[model samples]
Target: MTVWDRPEPPARPVPLDRERIVAAAIALADEGGLEAVSLRKVAARLNAGPMRLYGYISAKQELFDLMTDEVYAEILPEERPCEWREALRVLAHRTRRAALRHEWLADLLGGRPSLGPNGLAVTEAKLAALHGLADIDTVLRAVETVSSYATGAIRREIASRRAERATGLSERDWQRASGAHVTRMLATGRFPALASAVHDGADVDAETTFATGLEWVLDAVAARLTRPPA
Candidate 1:
């Protein structure tokens, strides 16, 4: 077919909504590091100019905010079960999954809260789940506690991954960190508690440490719930 007979190669559709642009940005961020995401990159992905992206998203920060909300939007919302422990367990797993799925999410999560509708929806869901606490102070503390745990877990995971990449170390090699080094220090038997703990096997695991801390926080929240109203 001649160039003109090709019927202009079928014009591709253009996205006109913020959701579409933000979705594109999310996909871009997922495949590449956050630094690889930019108006220019997104535009090129969409086969448009950088200025066209601004039409849908005002600034890169706005794009990031939208992407952040999109990640939170993945949180599954079920009416919190009757037991607070069950609710917390579900929420923690959901948050962990979202963070693990999106590598850039930990930083986005701890940054300024997004006021977008999707973000507000997630916040409202969390508040409602903790509404049984009835005390504003307790409720706020519970929210903050769980959120910090989730973010801290994700942050540690990311840091560990980065450290491994930088040092060309694998998990097997990771044991070398406090392995022989700390083990030898404890082997001196200067402190009975240290010796006992080392003999009992005191290996550190990111997942185990995270779950232990999360369980402790939830237990604290449960204690607060049972406390008599002042």
Candidate 2:
């Protein structure tokens, strides 16, 4: 005897595309932070299943790479600025803003294996910024120095932000927290430079500190480039 009727298959609409998935992931990150972003969450946001997302992105790392590139691509290189110094300043500030928007960015960029278009684009842009330098070796060194400083500075800034948010305190609170330790160290009279530096308000305005350090880095690069052949 034949079956009375065959059940009809469910109609499968066009599933979420990569761009849509990535967009949802970024929004999730913005709302709840990177920790809140997961394949399942992204899929849930799109009304799909976690396994469906895996088809478009092989792993969580890929998702992270895309998210990072999404953030990185927002920074625009300066166009014919007065000097490389100004260009570098703009690029540095732009990158700092990107990192601030997504605090986990520094940790991702610093240690992750290169994984996507945006990541490569950022590296390529930085390399291109040093294009006119005299030597490839020098250019490479400059890139290393600038990139290292950017990553480390961004990471520290993220930490400081998180600390402030969690403790409901500002840099002033940080100074207060360390006051005892600092005072005791000063009282010992063994570390003159450290004591004097702290007493003089060494860690003051963050913007000024960032710019000063970046300028110092640029100066060091220029010094190396102009040094006599050895």
- Cα displacement (angstroms), candidate 1, residue 79, comes to 5.5
Q: Which residue pairs collide, candidate 1?
A: none
| Model 2, global lDDT | 0.75
Q: Model 2 over residues 1-230: C-alpha lDDT tens digits?
A: 11112232343585567678788988898777789989999988899878777667777877887787777777665363545566666778888988777777766756753545656766766667677765788888887888788778778878888889888988798779989988997999999988777768555576777888898998998798678778
**Which portions of model 1 show Cα errors greater than 4 Å?**
1-13, 78-80, 177-180, 183-199, 202-205
Q: Name the lDDT value of residue 157 in candidate 1.
A: 86
Across 160-209, the per-residue lDDT of candidate 1 in tens digits comes to 87778888888678766659887777767777787787578667777777
Highest TM-score: give the candidate number: 2
Candidate no. 2 TM-score:
0.84
Judge candidate 2 at residue 73 and give its lDDT.
Answer: 76
TM-score of each: 0.81, 0.84
- Total clashing pairs in model 1: 0
